[model samples]
Target: MQQLSKSHIPFFVVLVLCFTPWLQSPSALVLGLILSQLGWVPTNVPIAKWTKKLLSYSIIGLGFGISLSEAFKATSSGIGLIVTTIFVTLILGTWIAIKIGLDKKTGYLISSGTAICGGSAIAAVSPAINANANQTGLALAVVFILNSVALFVFPVIGHALNLDQHTFGVWAAIAIHDTSSVVGAAGAYGEEALRTATTLKLARALWIIPVALGSAWYFGKGKQKLQIPTFIFLYIAAVVVSDLLPQFETLYHMTFSVAKQTLVACLFLIGSAISLEQVKEAGLKPLLFGVGLWLAISIGTLVWLLY
Candidate 1:
């Protein structure tokens, strides 16, 4: 009789367990944290240092998450303009990010955030773009920082313009990067904005599946094969289940927390890997590229959303 390989069992478990409807967000986060931290599962790098830093910075997520949820509940009114905003902004922003010399990976990450759900979009795309852990970490850092800033700033902007909740929702979904941040910003503005922003962000999140498949096809055919991030399905499944259980919908928040923690750990690993010397040695090329692309995407996305 032939025996099953040990690796196959783990693979099967990952595939099956992740799909179970009972699995919650926090559960996934815990699993990811364990796998990333311990040797229980392997990663391209160790994340202990990064995770520590992330924990320190996580107040950003905690504040952003609760506010964002509040915004969604309050803004149950707008729908049409929100869609238009997301479509227009994404196209413009992506073009700008790419034009500015941001490497394809960083450019895509920034654009995805502005165009869709922020950090989640970047997190979803990082692996597909073959981004180094550092690149992912840096991009995540930028998004969260921006989200925190937006939380403080966006409502003021909306108020200055005297924009209605629906308009602000579209703006938040189009311009903001993490859902929590979007929620925070939108909620600050109004409930109409929150609902619109969340719906639009969710719509944008769907893009990851196709993008992942396309990326796998694009990069895998060459000598360097890329693995699709199948774990995203866990996020999707969690969303679906959360939607079905309004009574326990906060479970999504738990997942969000978990994902945020894991991501922080990932960022810590990235920071440890990044050397001041390497940033200097790259002789401004990568820095130029990264910054330029980010600005370009930002401008382009803004144009698309507005025009």
Candidate 2:
């Protein structure tokens, strides 16, 4: 096999990723992970490093800056209804996924995608469970497929329920598995939904820091101290700094876009990591479980939002 330059693949893929319209943050992350794994992009590049640094600055300097700048602007009832829908879906999906024998690790991943952020949640949980690369890849794939469907289906369902833009945005943020999907679905409805959904999704993402740290302590007892993930700290720092300072505002925003683009490139790498020859090894069981879990969340959310 011919050897490829480290920068060559990433540079090429980055070009493609930059041009593509990533509808949501998770979509970009999924794509970035896949491409990075495939040698289609350079994972060793400074993108992740820069993002980490930027995020730290944002969190500290910016003061956990609002992800949903406009979400609070919505009517109280609309936001409450959206929150209720999300919580209900999360409970129902987790129960269903577990009842079907999905591994605890995979179950958490699916639940995170259903309940909070998508790939980020999965990434956070991976270290806690010591999830294999293939398992992570598969979980991401399942989330991606489900999110794509949610993009179209969510808007229609929201419309059918006569939900306003703010209400729909909240629903999209709460129900959609990935941030990108949330943005896409919300944007499909209107600018208000787009803004609200992004904010809501970001707020949900904040939960990962605590969850990761707790999971690390609980699960990493047998492992070496260094094995404990420190990235969560960086992620939190990033959020904090960005929210506190106005001077670094441009830097924070720049990194935000770059992070999203890098993630898209990562998705292509992840796609290559999938062992096509043995794709069926996980069998129909996990796939079926994932499907059922996804449906339960969707149906459950709809019911809560309507009733």
Candidate 3:
């Protein structure tokens, strides 16, 4: 068996710290980025796959902390906004990409990421469009950079605008690309915001199926199988189980708490995957397109929420 190297020790240590209360989402992300820059991330570990699994499990565990009635109300009230924003973001993103002369696949990937669930949207659409590694990597780099920024900036913007928890949650769900960042920002804001954001974001994520199928038809890759996130059904089931069995509320809360910490660790892994070379490879045009699309959605959503 291969032995653990001394160079890998720091990465393991920080990862463990991520599970503790001392390391929150933003800090964990920052630490991960630092690790990546320092070349401390272990090559043997499959960080991307691990991040995906941990995030899915954490999200499902979070369902235990939420009331199903509240989840329903949040989803129902924001259904119109979610649908509108998804379509609008895609259309606007396409336009911006064309104007900026961004690559079609890369542009669409960024737009899909912004319009839907960030990395998840990009991942689902990439295969449908038959995007090459460079194209997919560029798209993911843009979205990931923006997602990291949103984690820190959105909460500050919420406080500055004096937006209530519901408004902030909706804004985060719509504006942020990745579910992890949305949960991170909303969780920092308050419990109500976290619940609202989590429910709305997952509900929005359900659009991935139709969107992916549509992309395949549009891109003439009809044979591509869509990568649907099955965890969402499990998340819904968790909510149902939690609501129905109030007697096990304590156990549910414990699971939820553990899941939240796991999410922090997942963020760390996500951060460690982001290398300076990856950012450099993302290039200027695609990055600009991502930023512009993100700003349009973020500002537009915040204005609608405030008004």
- Tell me the TM-score of each prediction against the true structure: 0.60, 0.70, 0.65
TM-score for candidate 3: 0.65
- Report the C-alpha displacement of residue 115, candidate 3, in angstroms: 4.7
lDDT of 3 by residue, 187-211 (tens): 9999999988999987787676567
Model 1 lDDT per residue over 190-268, tens place: 7788888777665555555455456556546765656665554544455455555657646657755655654544443
| RMSD (CA, Å), each prediction | 10.5, 5.6, 5.5
Best by lDDT: 3
lDDT per residue (tens digit) for residues 1-307 in model 2: 3345854665465546643564344455455555544556444444434433333333232223434333334424355644554455456655776687666566656665566577666666665556655666677777878887888898888888788887788668766887768888898899988988777776666666656565566556766673545566666667656655657877777676566544444444444445544446667655676677667666665566567
In order, the Cα lDDT scores of the candidates are 0.54, 0.61, 0.80
Candidate no. 1 TM-score: 0.60
Please report the candidate that would top TM-score against the real structure.
Answer: 2
Model 1 bad stretches (over 4 Å): 1-100, 221-227, 241-256, 281-307
Off by over 4 Å in 2: 1-99, 221-227
